[model samples]
Target: MNTVTRPRILVVGAGFAGVECVRRLERKLSPDEADVTLVTPFAYQLYLPLLPQVASGVLTPQSIAVSLRRSKKYRTRIIPGGAIGVDLKSKVCVIRTITDQIVNEPYDYIVLAPGSITRTFDIPGLTEHAFGMKTLAEAAYVRDHVISQLDLADASQDPAERASRLQFVVVGGGYAGTETAACLQRLTHAAVKRYPRLDPGLIKWHLIDIAPKLMPELGEKLGSSAQEILRRRGIEISLGVSIAKAGPEEVTFTDGRVIPTRTLIWTAGVVASPLIATLGAETVKGRLVVAPEMNLPGDDGVFALGDSAAVPDLAKGDDSAMCPPTAQHALRQGKHVADNVIATLRGQARKPYVHKDLGLVVDLGGTDAVSKPLGIELRGLPAQAVARGYHWSALRTNVAKTRVMTNWLLNAVAGDDFVRTGFQARKAARLKDFEYTDAYLTPEQVRAHVEGTARQE
Candidate 1:
């Protein structure tokens, strides 16, 4: 009797792209046709766009973390681990589990969507002292740290110490930096009511970036509108400026300004995952260079997308233009890549990824927002509605959508108490303590490991 072998498909990462790809595969492919497996350290898909809200206490971390197993129809095997290395020649991916155990997972076809990491510079004391807004823990820790500063300032009689604790500086002027500065400023503004002794003017928020404009992708008119909104809220906008050095108690800007502050929130930008370096393939700005179809050049059955891949923007008709690293692109690329995978399995021609820009939304907390949905600029409550509506619709599961909506309603009614969760009490909650980017294997190590595993098998 002859038996047929099924193709084994392995997907790395659990971000928007990876989750969307898995969902599409599960919906389209039968068990007999392909065996789908996903590698991730967590079983939930993080709704990252709302992370600023999470940091600001408007939403809980659990509300944004959608469970991967919520869809009963999905039959993909879940390996609770992160891919540390990939050996393309052997068709094996090395994953490090939550328990710190390294295991090798082999596949006939692979999809890489490992996502991006917080890009850092060699500025002094940045990695050690500064806080990040990239992960859930980081967001929670930022909230705790921010509230703690208020608490410390309220109890202290020293004016200098109080000022240092009250002053907050945020780097970068993009969506992340702008939203973070806006939301956290509101948190402090609201929380100050609880501290009657604390002067509201002492609670300062300085939003600085090297770029000349804030949220420049929102276009000139809307970008100026966002800057004005932040400025009106008393957020000090320092355009064309960046941090020269970061200290535990203060930060010095490139323009010769030393601001005394205990908090420095770094939301500068992101780089592709370190896993891309292990592939030993061509890359554009640290992102894997893939064809228009989101497949590796000259390599069959291997795909890359999302923040980790430099996917061509065929819609723009620009040879040098690549898709920007955004959730909107990531989500669409995920579904398209899965379809192409299915097409390849069926021996059909693969389709190239082509999509026009939908628009941009930046929720500035409360009823203040700015959005350009399909080129129509909106502001205030109308823009707020569009921003929240887009996010609510973008949420993957019903449970996530319901929980987020409930949080919004409750926050609007009762308001946040500015309670500190004491996440900073643990040293591991620090920005440098998380992510562990150094845990990945180098290209040479990956080659040796793959050869050794093959010999053992």
Candidate 2:
């Protein structure tokens, strides 16, 4: 039987934005006002700031994800599917369910919060050869792969094979790349201690990027401090460089140097989801263009937010930029859009989106952190406390908050789980590997030849 009735408010993508929107609607509008339905491919909201901990084995995957049904304190119906295409003229959205079935959903009002996917560059052999740290499954795969590499290296007597397995290279100096490198480095250190045959010094981690410094978005001072701390932890930093060619067992640099390695992690950047393209709407940088009220230009009943929308930064004036894809902005935008949707029902004018930056924070695992809060620079424990506090408070469910805290308390008493058995089965997950290309792109038209096809198989 169909779950939703008409006059329904359809919200897409249950990340920070969609979740907040539904929560706010429950608080503001009575059940008699309108029926609210949330459609997403997943049933939980991912706490992104804690993802680094998941890859490090410090926090499990379940700790960061809040179940949608359990966490929803309202009467909103949750639909498990991702919107792939939209017929704006008819106000209908074509969705691809998680089980690969296509379903058509109609809505009176639409809120687009569908998040982004990994962005790809034209770098040679990158699409099929590199692994990304985007979702929970990706994070788990990385942890398993990294640990398995150590296990393989420790047992192998061949010097060449051991060297290839021991060297780990992470591309991109952004938070994902930087955190992945730091967390894995720590994981390796703890794992190798049990391997009496393996030398910890044999392990090498390289963090490469096209940019000059790491964490450039966090401003110059804090970004510099983050780079320094990482270097001190024995991580080799490579700036203004990127991989030229990548393969199953070797990767060559643009400067003509070649390094033999079985693992190449790609966390360069992200792009808007391919779902945006099928909307037949104007987009900037692959994001749906929205007015200050977060409403679509041609359609008054339609709205968009989060990584998928190119919302103008009103605080910066007419010549300013759009809001970034950070969790902070998504959460705020979700709440505001909920209010705007309600305002529409009452025939009230929508309010324009406006806000100032709340600074940035990056957790480097352990007790180490770097951040700029309210324009004041902080590092070490001071930054660590601030970073943890902010994330803990931002959690949508108290159960999630309690579980994460309990895990931390137990983790302090017990050391890391350093058995690296999963690394032996490195699956080689690439950017193009998880994309729903059949629906988004013509099979042979947009020839993004997924490189390293043989290695993955």
Candidate 3:
């Protein structure tokens, strides 16, 4: 007996958009309809918003890592690798696996959700010295590094060295940067009590950004409230400022002020994955240009979403305005794209992806927070409740929700143990370490690869 060949569907990345897309595809598509495969560097979908909490030891890494295998219902083939290049003409994707093995995958339909990398500048020593808060490993390593700094500071006899170790610089005023500075500052603040020789006053955290307003999207009033909250916690908020250079021991500001510090956390911004460029498709500001329906323009089988796609904001009734790269947008887009993909397979008409702005929430650690849920501005405890409540509800699986809730409750009741896993000991990772931005092949290389494979067969 002969079996029918199923349509191969390839999904890239395992972030919010990718994971949601795959899950939805598994649920909606019949067993014989399509063969789903996911290509990602990791096996889990990372809940990125709570990454700051993971770094500050408020939550364990496992709490935020939602395993893709958690579902017993889905049998999606998981490719533990990253797609380096895609030959859209041939419908082939070039992937580099974790073991440094290269392979080609052919698909009838492909979803590009490779997500974004931490955006760095041309400043000298930026990639060599700056720490990023974009990945689970980076977050864990940062926590260890921060704790180690305090330990080293207390042991040092030289006041200069101690001062430098105690001072920390975070370059970004966005939600990630602000929350990181706030959460880590609180960690150091609480940990200083254990060190008799270290003065709590010496622990300084400076949050800076080139933008004039910190999180200007929050509006002036709410942004001001967030700034005030951080300021009251002894965090120095510097607006309209940025790092000119970064060194192993110090960092210089764009305004020419030199600050001695052992730590430089860079959360400035993120750019779409370099994989998008391999397709040689039209892009808007480095993100692949896609229709409001989340399909690549002129390509019915190709879909792009998440941080890597410049999806038009149809909700605003503007063609130029694109959806912001937020978790909420990505999640909704994932579901929408899955429906569209299924629709295409069934030869049905597809609908556009349109979602209204559900507002923003910035958790400034502890009891401090600001939220604008449903256009209603809130601050302090009420805001914190709303923020946590929203995040808790957004978690994909029941296990993930339980772990996050348990971590939060445990941290609140017993406090952090301040233990380092030592996995990152003696291995300092910079901005370029986690983000393999330059790993993608050029369009010519992609064509050559696909053509070579075709000839070999």
Candidate 4:
């Protein structure tokens, strides 16, 4: 009797979707049934919603970056790399390892969940001067950069330079932008106390957005409530406006206002991962289009979810409607896709992904929050509780939950250190410095690489 080989499963990314998928697969599939492999640049699922807290120095980076290998029993073989391209025909994934090595990983089944990158426009000086809040490093760098500005402003005798260093401009009014602006404003507010020489009133925060309203998805009442809270905290909420051009020392708004500032934090939006383009598949708004079952239409053994795929929105009951790229959808889709993969392996039927909106939560630091959970509008401390509670429960591990809770407690009681980690001292960490948007293969290059790998095999 010959022993049958277990199916090899390859999962890309360690985000909410990919991590949840792998966890579900590990729980449901026995060692003899499947061999799981995960490819990611990092070995942790970055709890992204709490990234504002990280930037604000309320929580450490490690607390939100949940470790993938926390359990010794987890059987998935971890490959530390980012997938640059995938060939559906050849069933090979082209990966660029962290050590600058090229690897072609073949798989019996593939899950593409390679999340998203910071959405940027072609504004002249945007990428060159602005800072981003998308990744762990960017968050840390922002924290340090903000503090450094205070130090520089305090040391400088020139009034104009001091004013420029003290002013901070944050672009975008969505969840990330709003939270980032709010949290960092609080950080600066708190830090200025330590810098007695710096005028507290001079530390101005401007939150600008081209949209008519801030966090419009939060609805009228909740959105207005949030805007009010931010305004009360002294954040200059500039609606119906955006940056016309960004320079190192100043940003010119479309409304013809040039604000002098050394800091420009861009959190406008996110586009699907560039890896999606390499597949040469159908994409709606840069996201790969997948069936309701999270599988590629007419393409066997290929599945996509998270920010990369435009999964059908069955909950909306519309054929053309697709699920929004959110952590809420990503978490559920990850589990559903894993179940569908297991069903395919066992020769069983697959199920479609269907989930309703849970709600939105925005933590604005220091007991200020607005949330709409299960259709109930909450503000102030109650809303803060709801926001923190939702994020706490959503944490993947008990360790992460404990760390975050402890940090919250400490922040409530002890307050922040206001210490600069000196990340900016060694390098000029700008928007383009953090993300490698150029590090992807063209569709033609993907084909050529896949063909070459096939010949070698």
Candidate 5:
């Protein structure tokens, strides 16, 4: 054990909240006050909101991923590994490195900001046949896969295979799902023209969910308008339905509809990172339950925030409501956690978490969008302007902000290049080797699953 006088602070996940907490702690604390170390699977803070644009080739991948070491803020250490398990009683965290070595990370105080994992289902063949649109690699791979599918369809001798290649289905209609459908639709439209052998009319994009509207949270009026636009684009919208079964060549939905599709994107919803639940603490909807100050109750030096923590929304009149796991909420919660941590070290009063809803934005390719900012609704060009501006402002660095803007300008002028890379689609059968283990299995659960599958086989 390395001995140090500074009260060590170990923060997990380098998302918006973790980054903000580190920034605030560095500015407020001196070397004598506390030592801060942030651990993440990736060194960069991924701006998840713009991932759909990247997949559509509207923006480059680097535009959305921000490097943590580039900024010379407080002397904080960066651990390039995702934390897998913890021992709250021992104040020791076990993290698996990129090289698959499990090491112990001991700390005096720890903050949990590790984000969420895609919430998958047990639907037949869903895990093996579906593509998720959450990570940078996944997004990039899907873009290439979609483009390649178009190319293959245009050149294929078999009409059935060609049709299957052109039919794409996206599950979940929230922001991630909706934006993915819209952006990829744009990519397909732009790239399919290059394939003169194929008719554009043969292509189809479908969005399905077990809900009444595409984006139910966007309310009836605005959601209705968005639906009309999608309906006009010939993109099939199936509500109150989900994929019942998926195969390599076809998918059966709850409505008993069969669509031959080479591509199926799984963006249904997110669950709290499994790391939170392992803390031996209480949780709500898979997120670790924390006090109003973002501290784990009954633990003096433990804190959690971001997507993994079930932080109470005090602005809602003391109701035990967990804050929504959006990037907007994560960023603010991070700063507050840092401030509270700093105050605790100095014997000062910690503040409560309080934030009002700031509306929502949904970009639907080209210049079409749906947004409600400051209690005012806007659609089309106006919504596009606000949506773009909001994301531009959300990015942490000016270099990132400028690069994104430049990319957008160039995309508008040059149009998107729809060449397919097919990196992920090629590895669809072995995604577990590439993705974090948290997506599917807990260590114990994985052992049981392996044993069970082996026995059955």
Candidate 6:
């Protein structure tokens, strides 16, 4: 009797790249071709760009969190956990489940799409005192924290304490930071009307970046336009500056300015997932280095994309130039890599990933916006429409689309209630609280774990 062997394809992460790749694989591959498995800490694929809106109460958390199980054609075995290590030689992935159980998942092929985590520095009290807006819970927590600050400021008798509570500092000039400052400032601006004792003038928002410009990717004209719009909204723009140190009550800047603030939102940048370290592979600026086809050079059946891989930008025609970690690229790359994976399994040649820039959008809340679609620069209301339309149309499912559309309409007409969910009432959260970057195993440990020689602590 002859037996047939099926290939096991394991995907890491539930991000845009991972979800897209898995969906495509399921659609393209037959049941007998391969068995697909996905390892993720969450069941939903988080639409990360709209996170600032969630933080500002413009959209509920569920609107952007598209459920992975919603697909009726689903065949992938969903693993409710995170891949802590990957032993390339043994072709095994070590996963830590939600219940803290360890499992060794053997795979014929592996696709690494574990997304990046918020990058931090060695500044004093940075991780201990600062809050991040990467995860859904973090965004919700931030909204509650911001409103709590307003409440505390209004109720406080100590003038100094009130001043500190009212003053907010957001660090980073990127999309997340800009949108966060713009949206939350609007939140506080409109929220002060509800608090009778609070003076709106007392609420101050400072947007700072060590870089000279706000959103340098938007080019000079659009960047200047964004900066002007933000400044006009009473947000203090401080370029060429960064936080030297953070404290419970205040933050010291590199320029020697001490700002009395209780809230510090850091969105500086992101480093690739720590899971990449387990492979003991070559990396570029902390990202796993992969070919234009997105496959590991020396390792067959191993692929990586999204924030975790430094994939070469084939459209640029330069080997040294790598694709920037963006949602647009990740979504496209996911589909492209899926085709490559299918072709590889079918014994066909894989093509290189090539894509041109499709422009950018920056929503500044309400009528204020800026976008560059197909190289055409747009600002104000037209840009807002373009930005929102692009986001709405890009949603994965009809349910997600409906939920987002409903949220947008409700927010516009009824506006926000500005209610806190008490996520922060139990305790304050740090960068380490949400992201488990330190939980990944080393290359040696990965081998030991896969071989069942290492003891589980």
Winner of 2 and 4 under TM-score: 4
Ten-residue segment with the worst summed lDDT in candidate 3? 418-427
Candidate 1 global CA lDDT score: 0.93
Residue-level lDDT tens digits of model 4 in 1-457: 9988878899999999999999999999988988999999889999999999999999998999999888988889999889999988888899999997989998999999999999999898999999999899999999999999999999999999999999999999999999999999999999999998999999999999989999999999999999999998899999999889999899999999999999999999999999999999999999999988999999759999999999999999999999998999999999999999999989899999999999989999998999999989999999999999999999999999999999999989999888888677665779998778888999899999888877887
Query: Candidate 3: RMSD over Cα atoms?
Result: 1.0
Q: After superposition, how far is residue 217 of candidate 3 from its true place, in Å?
A: 0.9
Please give the CA lDDT of all the candidate structures. Answer: 0.93, 0.83, 0.93, 0.93, 0.84, 0.93
TM-score against truth, every candidate: 0.98, 0.92, 0.99, 0.98, 0.94, 0.98
**207, model 2: CA deviation in Å?**
0.6
* Residue 388 shift from truth in candidate 3, angstroms: 0.5
> Which 10 residues in a row give candidate 1 its minimum summed lDDT?
426-435
Error of 2 at 97 (Å): 0.8
Note the residue pairs that clash in candidate 3. Answer: none
User: What are the per-residue Cα lDDT tens digits for candidate 3 across 326-384?
Assistant: 99999999999999999999999999999998999999888999999999999999999
**Which pairs of residues clash in candidate 6, taking residues 3 or more apart in a chain or in different chains?**
none
User: lDDT tens digits, residues 239-261, model 5?
Assistant: 99999999999999999999999
Candidate 4 local accuracy as lDDT? Answer: 0.93
Clashes of 4: 0
